[model samples]
Target chain A: MAAGKPVVMVTLVSSDGQSFQLLEEAALLSAMVRDTIQIGQGRGPAGIPIRNITGQTLSMVVVYCNKHYTAAAAADGDDAADEEKKVANKKQLREWDEQFINLEQDKLYDILVAANNLGIDGLVDLCCWRFADMMKGKSASEIRVKLGIRDDFTSEQRAQIEKDSPWVWSRTT
Target chain B: MLQPARENEGVWRLSVWCFGVDAGVQFSRCENPIFPLIPSMAQDGGESRDWAEMPSDALSGVFGKLNASDILTGAGLVCRVWRQLATNDPTLWRRVDMSCQADLVENMKAKYAMARIAVNRAAGTMEAFSAEYFVTDDLLLYISTRASSLKSLHLIYCPYISIKGIAEAMKGFTQLEELTLYLSSFHGYVSEAIGRAGQQLICFRLNNAFGYYNCPVDDTEAFWIANNMPELRELQLIGNRLSNDGLIAILDHCLRLESLDVSRCYNVQMDDVLKSKCARIRDLMLPRDQDVFIDSDPSDEGYSYDTDAMYDSEY
Candidate 1:
C-alpha cells in the first residue's frame, strides 16, 4: 500500500451470511482474500464470499491479521532507537498472540481450520502451537481424550508394543 | 507400530497450491474437524475430496515437531488413523533425538532399542541426529549401517560415546557436514579420522554444549581440524587448549571462517595481528578475559530458580 493512495474497504461475507467490512491493507493480510478482492479490481465494491469460514471464526482471524499487520509495520519502521522498539513491539505482540489463541478446545479447532482455509500463516502457526501445547507432557489416554481419537488398539497388540519399546512408554512425563 | 494395510494411505504431503491461481476449491460439511464445516453448496454425490478425512499436510506439520519418543510411544498408539500417519514414513524419522531420556543408564538397552526404531524407520534418509545421555559402541555401529545420509551428528552430552564407536561410525557419515561433540572426547586417532572423513564439514562446535563438563578441547584436536575440513565456516572450540601456533594454523588455513567461538580457549594467544584477523570475522566470541568480571562462576548471575523456591546456581 503506497502513501496518499486511497485505501479501498473490502466487504467479506462469511458462510453464515454475515457481512464485515475491513481496510484493504488489513484484509490483504490473507493471500486468499487479497487475491479474491484483486480479481474484482475496478469493477465495483464487490462483496467477496468466504464460503469456507464462519462469520465468528472469520472475525477472529481478521482481528489476528490486523494486530499482526500493524505490529509488522511498526517493527519495519525507522532507525537509532528502532531496533530496541522493534524487539519490544515483537515481544508485546507475542504476548498478545498467546492471549488471543487462549480459546476453548472446540473454538481453537475451528480457528485452526479457518486459518488454514484463509491461508493465513501467522494464525496457523499460533493455532498449531496452541494445539501442540495441549499434546505436550500428556499421557497416551490424555492425548486421545483431547484429540477426539479412539483407542482401537487390542490388548494383545498393546502388550506387544509395550514389550517392543518399553523405555519410550516408560516416559510418563 | 501397527502396519497399515496400504503403504501410503494417510501419508501427509505438503501441498504448494498457489493462492488465486487455483481458487477452484469449495467448502462443505467436513466430517473431519480440521476442515471448515460449511454446509455443502453445489452438492456432489461423492464424499468430500479431503480423502484423508482431515488436512493431512497440516497433520504432518504438527507431527513433524514432536520428538521421536512422543510419536513412537504416545501418538502412534492413539488411534488407527494416527498410527498410520505416524509410523508409515521414513523421512519422518530423519531426526532421532533420544537426549530427552533422563535416567539413561537404567533403561539403556530399551532406550537404544527405541532409537533403533527411528534408525530403522529412517532407512538412510537420516539427515540430522542428536543423541545424548548414553550411547555405546554397538549403538553407534548400528547407526552407521542405517544412517548413510546423516549430515548433522551432535553427541553433545553423550559421555559414553567412545572414540572407537564414533571413528568407526565416521566411515558411514562421509556426507556429515555439521559435527558437534561435547562430553565425548576425541583423543588418539579419532580426531585424525574425523579430519580424514569430514571433507564437507561446515559447522563444528565441540562447545561442551553449555554443560558443566570440564573436559579439555586441546591442540591435537585443532591440528586434526586444520588438517581436514577446509570448507569450515562456524567453528566453536570452548575450553580449547589451542596455543598461539594452533590458533595461527586455523587463521592461516580455514579462510572462510565466519563465526568463531573460542570462549574458554584461554591458552590461545591473541596478539595485535591475530586480533585484527579475528576482528574481520562476522560473528566472534573471543576468549573471555579475566578483567571483564571478577566472579568465580562466569556463566551465572543467579537468575534461575529450581523447584521448592530455591535459587540454583551451576557454580
Candidate 2:
C-alpha cells in the first residue's frame, strides 16, 4: 500500500546503547511501540530507549517483526486475492517462523521475555507454543530436566500431588 | 532515499540489511519509537532469572496450549510456582475438559479421581465442563454442589451416570446455557428437570447411536425439549427416533430456533408442510445429510461415540 509513499522510519535504542532503525509499520507489531507512537512519547531527538533488552536480543526482535510485517504486507497485496495463494503464503510464513524460532534455550528465553515486555502477542504465543511442545508427553522430571527447572518439592509435597491425582503420574498410553 | 543525519543523530548510523526472499527491507528511522521499560517476568525471580519463577501470565500462555493431562501431571509437578498455578488458578480450571484421554480410560477409578481433582481446582467457579466415559452419579452430584456458575456441560458416553443423577444435577445448573449428551441414555425425569432448570439454555444436543435398525419411532425426548426449552437457538437430535409429530411440536414451541439437526433420524418424514414450517431455520440438517456426526465426539482418539447398545428403543 505504501509502495510510492515515503516510508516512515522509527529508531529504537537497545539497553546497551545500540540504536537500530526500522519502518514504522513493522515497529508497530509491538503494542508498546504502537501505544508510544499514538501518545507521541517517542518523538525524541534520539531513538526510544528499550530498557532491559540487550542490543543482541533487540536486533533479533527487529528482524522478526520486519519479516512478519513484510509477509503480512505481501499477503494483503492485490496479487494475493486468490484463496489458494493466501493459504500458500500462510504456509510459507509458518515455515519461516519455525526456522526463525529454532534458537538455543537461553536465546528462546530472551526472545520470549522481550516479546512479553514489548506486548508482542504473536511472538509470545509462538514462544509459549514452543515451550508447550517441549513439555508435551514428557514427565514432570523430564520437563524439569529439559527446561532446567530445579526439583524443589519435598517428599511430602510430591506424595500429596501424586495422591491427589494418580492418573496424572501413570502413563495414559 | 538516504536523508542527512540530524544533529542529535551524530552517534547513530542506519544500516540497511537485506532480509531473506524480500530484498532491501529497511529497518531504520521512525518519528516515534517504543520505550518498553516494563520489567520482564525473569526479573521477578531476581538477577538469576530462573525459569521456574517466571510470572503467571507467561506460564498461563503455555498452560493454554496444554491438555488436561499435561496440566495435571507435567506442569503442575514442575515447580512450586507452576504447581501453585495449576492447582489454585480458577481461570485455568474455569473450563475443564477431561474428555478424549484414551489412555486415561483404562483406569476408570483414577480417571474419576483426576476429574474430581480438576473440579476442586476450579474452586466452584467453573463455567464450562466436558468429559466422557468416567463420569458417575457421585461425581455429577459433586459438580452440581460446587459448579452452580457452570454455563456449558458436555457429557459423552457416560454409562455410569444414572438418570436420577442427571436430574438431581440439573437442579444446581440453573444458569446453564449449552448442554450436550452423546450416547448417554436418559428418560422423562431427566428431561423434565433440565427443561425446568435450564431456562437460559440456548443449545441442546442429544445424539444417539447411528444406523437403520436403531430406529424406535419415539418422540418423547423431542416433545420434552419443545415444551420446555423456548429459548433454544440450536437443537441437534442426531440419530433420534423422533417422528414428524415431534418435529412439529419442536417447531411450534421453539420459535427462536435458528438451527436444527435431525441427521440420521429416519423416523422424521420432512413432508413439504413440515419443510415449509422449518424454512425459517437458517441451518436445517435433514436425516439424509452426510457426515452429520463429524463434530460429534471430543478430540480424543480411542473412545468413539458409536456404541451399538446406546439406545434401547423399547422404552
Candidate 3:
C-alpha cells in the first residue's frame, strides 16, 4: 500500500477452487489484467474470481507468473552477480516453458481457455504459435483429423471444398 | 424351486441391461466435451507429444502476420482451421502494393478482389488503397465500392484513369487523409472533381498532370483550388503552366499550406513567386538555374532574357 513500492500482489481464484497469488507487475504483462487492476484500485488482492479456468490450468498460469516475477526482480537489481543470475534464470524459464507447453490436446484447450480468462497474453501467444507450428506441413484432411473437427460438409460440399482448392491436396502428397 | 431360479435369472439380466444403457449415455455425453480426448488416448498420447489446441482468437492473431501471397496459396488452402483464420485476418489485406508486378496486372486484380472480400469480412472496412501501375477507370470504380472507408491512396503512372473515376472514388472516401497521383494525363476537370469530393485532404501531390496547355489559360485551376482544398498541407506541382498570378492565387487560398513543389514551372518568375507567395514553403524544388533579377528600372519589357538559364533547368 506504500507509494513507490514497485510491486502489488493479486489473488486469482479458478473455477475448480484453486488459488493463484502473483505479483502485480508480472501480471501487468497482460493488458486486460493490468486494466482490470487499475480500475479495481488495490481491491484485486481480496480475490478476483476467474470462473472459466480449471485447477490444472490455474496452476500453470501461476508457474508462468512466478518465473517472470523472479527474472524481472533479478534484472532490476544493479550488480554483476544479479545480471549473471538473471541470464541463467531466463534460460531455465525458457526450458520450463518449452516443457510446460507440451500438453495433450484437451489439456492444451483448457490452458488456452484459462490463459484467455486470466488475461495472460504471453501464454496465449505461445500456445497459438505452437498450434500454428503443428499445422505447418499438414494437409487439410490431416489437419481436420488432428483437430477433431467434425466434417460439416455434405458429400457434394466436401467435393467442392477440395475442387475449389485442389492445390491443397496436390502440394501435401 | 423352478419359479425361484427363473426370478433370480430375470433380475440378473435386468441389472446388466441397465448398466449397459448407463454406460452408453455417459460415453455419448463425454464424446466431444469442449475438447477431444482421442488424441491423448492414441499411440503418442502423452502431454509431451500430443499437439496443443489453440483458441480461435489466438489463431486469428497468428494468421494476421502472414503476407498476401502466403495467405492466398498456403494459408487460404489449408484446413478449415487455417482457412477460417486467414479469411478473418484484416491486417493481411491492408496495403495491396501492386506496383512491382506490372506484367501480372490482370492476375493482381483478381487477387486484389479476393483480398478485399477477406479484408472487408475481417475488419468490416478497407482503409488503405495503393496502386503503382496504370489502373483503369472501371477498376478504380470497382475498388471504390468496397473500399468506402479508404484513408490513403497512392497511384503512379496510371494513364487510363480520368478525373471522373477519382471524383467518384473521393466522394465515398470522406476520411481520406493523403492522395498521391503522378504522371497522369488528367487536366482541370480532375482537379475540379477532387474539389467536390468534400474531403479535408492533408497531403496532395499532382505532378506532370495539370498544366496550362492541358487546360484553357483561364482561371480554372485557381477556381478549383479556392473551392475544394482549403485544408491542404502539402502541394507538389511539376511541369504545370502555373504563372505568377496562379501561384499567388493558390497561396492566398490554402492558408494551412506548409510544403509546395513547383519545379519546371518556367512561366512564373522566381523572385516574385518564391519570396512573396511561398514564404512558408520548406522543401521547394524549383528550376535551379533561374536567378532572381532585381532590376533598378522596373519598366523593361524588352530586356533580353538569358536563354542559358532556360536551357540548363531542363527537368
Candidate 4:
C-alpha cells in the first residue's frame, strides 16, 4: 500500500453469515482473500464469503493479518532504522505471535486448519510449532492425554514400538 | 549383539500396508476399499480432517518442527494415522539427528541398528546426518551406501569413526556443504579426502577438546581445508593446533571466508598483520573473546553433559 493511496476496506463474510471488514492490504495476507479480491468479488454488498472458516476463527485470522500487516508496513517504512531497532521490532512481533498463538488444544486445532485452508503459511507454521512445543519432552501417553488424542495402538503394537526404540521413553529428564 | 533385520518387520509391515492401500487406489480410482487391519481411515471422502484425521500436509507441517527423538517417541506414536505418517514420511528423516540421544542407547550395535532404521526411513533422500558416541566405521559405511544425497555430516565424540571409514564415506557425500567434527581422532588425510570430494563445502567446524590445557596444535588440518575447500564461508577451528602460519594460509587461500571462529586456538596470536589479514571476516572470534566454546566438564570420556549441550551452541 503506497502512501496517500485510499485504503480499500473489504467486507469478509464467514461461514455462519457473520461479516467482518478489513483493509485490502491486510486481508491480502490470506491467499483465499487475495484470490477473491483478484476476481473482483469483494466489491458487493454481501461481501466475500470465506467458506469453512467460522466467525470466531476468521476474527482470529483477521487479528493476525492486521497485526502482521502493520508490523511489516512499519518495517518497510523505516528504511533507515538501525539494525538494533529492527531486531527489537522483530522480537516484539515474535512475542506477539507467541502470545496470540497460545491457545488450548481445540482452539489451536481450529486455527491450524483455518490457517491452512486460508493458505496462510506463516500462521500454519506458527500453529505447528506451538503444537510441537506442546508435544516436546512428553511421553506418548502424556502427549495423547494433553492433546486429547486416542491411542488406537494395541498392547502388542505399543510394546513393539517401545522395544524398537527403548531409549526414546527411558530418558531421565 | 546385532539384532536380526527381521526385528524391524512390524514397523515395515505398517508402511507396506499404507503403500498397498495407496497403490490399490491408484490401480482402481472408482473403488474406495478399506483394508481390515487399518480400519475406518475415511480419508479422501469429503470428510473434515482434524488433528486425529490430519492430511499429509498438516501432519508433515507438525512433524517438520519436531526433532528426531520427539518423532521417535511421542508424535509418531500418538495413533495409527500418526504412526503411518511417521513411517512413510521421507521428509521427516532428512536430517537424522541421533546425537541428542546417543548416550541413552546402551550399546553401539543397537545404535547402529537404529541408525540403519533412520537411513532406511529416509529412503535415499537424507541430506543431513548428525551422530555422537555410538557411530562406528561400519555404520558410516552403511550410511554411505544409503544416503547418497547427504549434504551435511556432523560426527560428535564418535571416537570409533576412524579416518578410513569417514574417507570412504566422503565418496558418497559429494554434495556435502557443512562438515562438523567435535572431539574426534580424524587426522589430516580425512580433511584432504573431504577437500578432494566435498568441493561444495561451505561451513567446516573441527572443534577439538575445548577448555583443555596444553592441547596439541598443528597446521595440517588448516592447510588441508585451505588447499581443498576455497569456497568455504564459515570456519570454526576451536581448540585446534592451527598456528598463525596455518591461519595466514587459510586467509590467503579461502577468499570467500565470511565468519571465522578460532576461539581456543592458542597458537594463533592476534598480531597486527594477522588481524589485518583476518579483517575481511565479518564474525571473527579471537582466542580471548570470552572463550564461548569453553565447556567446564571437558573430558576424554564419551559422555560429557556440557558437550551434549554444545550441540546447539553457535560455532
Q: Of models 1 and 2, which has the larger DockQ?
A: 2
Clashing pairs in 4: B217-B241, B218-B241
Which prediction has the highest TM-score against the true structure?
2
**Candidate 2: misplaced stretches above 4 Å?**
A3-6, A38-41, A71-95, A167-173, B1-49, B187-190, B211-214, B291-315
Candidate 4, residues B1-315, lDDT tens digits: the string is 011123233543454476553221221112223443432232222122245686568778998899876777678877888888888999999998878773455656656776887898899999999988888888888898899899888998888877788788888777888999898655544677664665778999877665343444468888887888888999988777778899999999999999999877767778999989988899988875655555443343542334434433522
In order of DockQ, best first, we have: 2, 4, 1, 3
Q: Kindly report, for each predicted structure in the order presented, the TM-score of its chain A compared with the true chain A.
A: 0.82, 0.90, 0.76, 0.87
Give Cα-based local distance difference scores for all models.
0.66, 0.75, 0.59, 0.75
**Residue by residue across A1-173, what tens digits does model 1's lDDT show?**
34787877777777766677767677787778877767765225557778866666677777887788777666655454667777787789999999999875545666777777788877888887776676765667657554445567677866776777766555422
lDDT of 3 by residue, B1-315 (tens): 001112233433353354453211111112435334533222111232222235666556555544454455554555555565566666656765545444555555544554445445536366666665546776777667667677777888787787777777777667787788887666445567775453488888876742321222334655576567888888876656666677777788888888887764656567854576666777666633222443333235444355456435532
How big is the positional error of residue B147 in model 2, measured in Å on the Cα after superposition? Answer: 1.2
Error (Å) of candidate 1 at residue A107 is 0.8
Candidate ranking under TM-score, highest first, comes to 2, 4, 1, 3
Deviation in Å, model 4, residue A39 alpha carbon: 1.7
Question: What digit string (tens of lDDT, one per residue) describes model 3 on residues A1-173?
Answer: 33588666777666755666777776676666677777865344556676766555666677777777666676666465676776787788778787878764545555766676666877887676665555554454454455554334456744764565443445433
The candidate 2 chain B region of ten consecutive residues with least summed lDDT is B23-32
Q: Model 2, B31-140: lDDT tens per residue?
A: 11231231221221112235787757888888878876678778878888889888777777888888887775577887677678777888888899899888998999
Model 1 chain B TM at 0.70
Candidate 4 is graded, for docking, as incorrect
